[model samples]
Target: MALVGPEEPHYCNHHVVASTGRTRKMTLVRALRPFRVVRRTLAVFTLGAMVIVSFALLPSNVADAATVPVSTQAVVQTAPDLAKICARLKITVARTSLCSHGPDPVDAFGGGARLKQTSAVQEQGVAAAPASELTALCNADGVSGKRIEVIYGVPQDRTNRFSAMVAPLRDMMRQVNNNLEAADAATSQNYRFLCTNGVDVTVRNVTLLPVGSDASFTFDDYVASLQNQIAFGLGPVDFIANERLYIAYIDQVQDSYPFGGQGELSIDDQPSAAANANNDSRPRYSMSAYLDMPVMAHEIGHNIGAVQDSAPHSSKGGHCYDEADLMCYDDGGLYFALGGTLTFTCPGADTAIDCHDEDYYYPGTPPASNYLATHWNTANSGFLTPVVSAATPPTVTGKSPVSQATRVAQTANATATFSEAVQGVSTTTMRIKNPGGTVLSSAVSYNTTTRVATINPSASLAADTKYSVSLTGGVTGIRDLSGSPLVSTGWSFTTGPAPTITTRTPGSGATGASRTASVSVTFSEGMAGVAASTFKLKNTATGAAITALVSRNGTTNQWILNPSATLAATTNFTVTITGGSTAVRDLAGNPVSTSIWRFTTGS
Candidate 1:
């Protein structure tokens, strides 16, 4: 039996024994005094002038046959508290008490402390290992299955420093591939890893900028710089669905604290320029120049959507409790032994303590069950599939008020129909700007069924004013389901002059009007349609309602209201236009406001 530290290599010592008929290899340790030993026969012989003693004995059944020379000391080699281990490494954990009783801690040595405090590495801008010569680090000969491209970038000024990291980065990636392959084999999946080679791999020299007052730059800022490079044809072609882009820089990343890398499960295909040139359906991840195999594998695990702290895996809260799990915080091994094996042995299965039990462990306030059984099952076999093609870019096919059109309604909602169904087409992407380029306060929404994006201003537009609607494009622009972005452009239109009642047949305050006379109102602009329900005729004295039929003349923009019955004699009749419906809109769909007029009917 052998005992090793959490992160140390395994070691075993063996001794060969010659028996009467067969040769058996046996392991002997000095610490085996507790168990009773029954000896039946003994023999002594001399080989090369050295005396050798042998004995055949009946061993006690107290120990397992597989673990030879087992003793009390070997079985009692307990692991230390995780909190103590973290404290010794100068790393901080959210819950110290929980960690105290959690999993055993992995020993820290040879820059292991830096790996434990990922955020510290970013803050201090510390390098993990010395740089080496630049060379072809990854082996491509054995990769015959599915491949994912990796693009590494560095600041132009720090090329030499980043070049030295190629060897270690290659080693880390190889380990990650090996671990993933082992996991797939255990889970009965067929996912394999391929290193981007030849023209597929990219090495970019980018400009570094400080984030706010901080001395370091952010991953998002770096991504933006990469985008700018792509836009200018200096960066790699648009990432395809199967590729991932990793930017390596000397400065610390803003959000990556206590970790060496950060990544997303997947990313939308944004426009890019590279050898492949096609839009990629996969997401990209980033790493600091200072990284190790375990940390690198951990980030790739995120890309694999493992142990997510949401939905089906909410109970795991970002990681499994098993210390041997590659997804755990104390991860140190190169293989998956927890959820990947599908044979779950709850940590501390025999103990009644809540902290020892996997089910009652509350890494979160509301205790959650270990969701490993839910996500790591055989049913979710396709979790490792890569997204394939980029989505088609959305195009504007039509607008409510056609470009450069006159007589646009002030109350009309600004609408633009796209060539395909799109999402996230809200106020953030679509904007209505006045001639002065000031964005108007408006609510923007997209209708999937109609493929239309509508922007309704908080208030009606200024009459006779010019406004332009702009939609953004590129990575941050509005995108379709496949993440293809829309091309950005602006269209302008002038609002029509304020609509007014130019003439009324039954003039306001008219006296001695015929009881059977119909009323007519003419507007300056063409009306969309008038609803009969919008016209209300009532006798003021009796407060009696009168129903009427309303009709509109398309060319004249006039609304005619004829009472269903004769108006009351010697009575003051009021005709009112009740608005607030699609029925009473202008040609541009602007609803009219309430209008009232009165006339006296003859007796």
Candidate 2:
């Protein structure tokens, strides 16, 4: 079903698109660089009020925070101030988007209602296994055999504040996963990070870096240090052959840093893949900036695969220019960097991965030989929920009195089931109106657990009237929690009298009825579903129904009941058309009130 979402994100379809440009990028092999746009958001929330709030809220991802016996460490000093973080990064630029917005609370969607920004959405699903309860394999939860290991990487010179961060880190990661889950929900997929027993992110039992963070570290330094440390520490078993993405959450003062985190981009623009240390075509490691959910999601987004140079909207440093998208920003190449205007109209959720599917992420079975198909697809990433064809925004999956249904009960509640859980439903979003278009007073409520939204009229509907039910979607309209707006859809149904048998063959209680002939009953209106349960023949004395072959004559609006055998002479039989919702219904779905008639057969 078509879902109403933000104006389809604008993209020049024919611009730079190639069936295969593998030749150009084949020789330009490079790992992730430091200044990608996603890393530009300088949200230093962990050092401010968010740490105070998020730390206190029990992470829904973790079943329990106290269960994992963690290593003890020094009490963490108050998180670094925004000034300290920006200073550490040597950011002389004035604060606006990322750098200074750390302490100033803002909506996660950034500038629009189209998509949900990357933040923790409370998921009412089963709790992921705690760290201590993790299974023998890394595939215990999401994406088989691969995992994103979370670590509280401490700086040796800064301080070992491991103990204080366990809960906060788990909570922080929970926000990231929730956003991912929301994205998955939007795409009609189920992608999520591996949540092992420890911190809902693997850190405890798995080998983590023992060396602490050093002062004045660079992106290159961090990458090389961790790679070397893990290579030496893992000792050939999990290290040399390991194909996991390691996420390090360090409590370092982030001043003077140009990036919040850096990760190796495993997506190759070339069609023929080259062999690597992990063998799998996915990023192996990402570091820092995870204390913030959006940045964490952005960094990890690079790890899985996204915003590649091959994308239509891609910029020089691996970002999109479609404003309001989590990955879109003016990072120096695309429209935003070329001095073009941005509408801030990114579709779906603020944290939505690819503003337009054609660019970095394709929710569909990518057409053969295209950039999306040849390059790694985030929708098909081993770490995400398996893809199912193309993904559409959440929509009304089912509805009551489906379009064009007749004979709807005036008191019946008009219910709608969404493909996934949605929010912002009201009379303004959904409504029932008469044929003349006067809206009925209605109440709408949504059930998060069932993903159903219900709407009921304040009073019973009018009899014999045609009414329509409409649901609206778009930015500021009905939207799924994951960020897709329901596309507007409505069906009309007529309300009227239930069909009744207008006349019966051989008038009721007639002295003689033809034993060799069939019995017929005509209804007041055209009939649709007529079954044995609704149309039955029974011996008046024995009360046993006669087996009969029933057929309808559309021209006459009549149902003919022919018994399997000749009727007994001089016997009285009763014919009944049972009513009620499940009984015999008319084309308009109105059921006939129960009616019974008796006739005597000829001797």
Candidate 3:
């Protein structure tokens, strides 16, 4: 595949503690062996802080993702752990441990994205008010668009404390969202985090994480228990499956040393039924509680798809290769494969995404050849904001063949070129019909790159016929990307004249022609097909047709009549091009009229 991108990564919003001014050197060694199971929920990369970069490549066709909805099921079907699952599918998997950081820490509390809550503060059923400074961090009232739904979960023995921390979580996410906006200023787009839309949305007392009496629980255990109890976010329904990124705030940590959080990497949401399975679709609910806002950001990054293996700096383990960005790490994510080293290139703020813009997030339109343009981009995730505006955008015409034009080609298809990208291209929307209003059997197709929609007729148009093209629909019809319709009476044109003999080899009534000579003829227009019965060579004296093989040259538009036996020497022979709609015809179905010519052959 030809990858189109800048040789070096785009350094747009470089937020780093130190600009070492280092150039990231890379040696790309394709898989030494076959690629095996690489987890979407990869190892947490932490410099005493939690982090996870989700990685998955999305489908290419969908205009916008319709996320899977959460279903009201009592129990969720759980799959085997990553290794076992891969084994069943006959894939070899080897575990690689990767976690480190870029620049030295400046703050004692330090910085990390996605993590565990250090303290379990208690409160009543109501939520705790945020610190005055954190109030503006979130907007929960009118802008109540889609967000990450937070749940309060604890071991059966422990009390749930997330109910008290709703505002704080929202505020933390608000801070992350705001930081994303700042990073994306170059793209001219605002960013928002997945948060509780309106009120403090929390599902309390779902399932229990392993604690107290429970023995050695794996990371998967925590997610499974909670998933079994919470009755939503299964999928299929658009909003339910996709609208919310369901995450739970568990009050306790597990025996597992790396207990920040993890999520399934849907990569890019491939909308097909099989591709959109279990957690494979929606980053379907795995990551858990962490007071650090960036931790949530990093963990959620996995759920929505980021850091594809094909990315320039990708670690191949679902994390980025460089340092200082939220997903990048000091201990190369692809340690065993890439020699386990990363240069401290683009040092970034606590909320950094890719060290450079080439890995995951791109605010503006990406180059058609850029990695972000093809892979799943976190910025396109449905959980972000401001919600896409519902307003309809108009579709304007760029150009088309003028109406009432004459001598149009019989086999030419009709097209409408638009100045802007359009959406509707179904047969019902873009149309081709006879002047009498009879719709023709045709298919409609649109090319986004060229901004053109075409009407391809099933068969060629008839010769000397008038056909009309029209686009219909109000705001909802043959519309632009923004839902504005292409409402036009369209245009029409008339096909050119009928087919006639343009060339005849061996002149009419010519005498002394060689008996072995083959007869040839050409037509004025390109023919749809040549009929065997239409070409003939016969001895005029005997009144019998000559056995001959007829062959046509489409490129030269010539038909050759070769007799099986040599023509009778010194005999008068006749040649004919039989015609009518059923015989030799042009693409427009216009026939070549029956034509005859006679010649006497020489011995």
CA lDDT of each candidate?
Answer: 0.41, 0.50, 0.48
Looking at candidate 1, what is the lDDT of residue 505?
Answer: 73
Q: Candidate 2 on 36-61: residue-level lDDT in tens?
A: 22222323322332332220111111
Better model by lDDT, 1 or 3? 3
For residue 276, model 3's alpha carbon misses the true position, in angstroms, by 8.7
CA displacement after TM-score superposition, residue 358 of candidate 1 (Å)? 12
Error of 2 at 511 (Å): 99
Question: Model 2: how far is 120 from its true place, Å?
Answer: 15
**Which consecutive 10 residues in model 2 have the weakest lDDT in total?**
14-23
lDDT score at residue 404, model 3, on the 0-100 scale: 38
Task: Give the CA lDDT, 0 to 100, for residue 136 in model 2.
Answer: 15
Candidates 2 and 3: which is better by lDDT?
A: 2
TM-score of each: 0.29, 0.41, 0.40
Across residues 1-603, which tens digit of lDDT does each residue of candidate 1 receive?
122234512110011111111112222122221011210111111121012111111111112212111111111112224234333322221111111111112221112232333323222322221111001112233233333333445443233445544433443343233333223111111123343443112333344322332233333334433434443333445332333434343333323222244443221111111211111223344444344444445544444433332222111223333322344332211111122211222231111112221321211123235432222221122223331122345666677776544557889888888777876676767888664446799998888899888999999998766576766554656767788765444455668753566787789999899988788888777654355655667887777888888786656778888888988787888887653212344543344666888999888
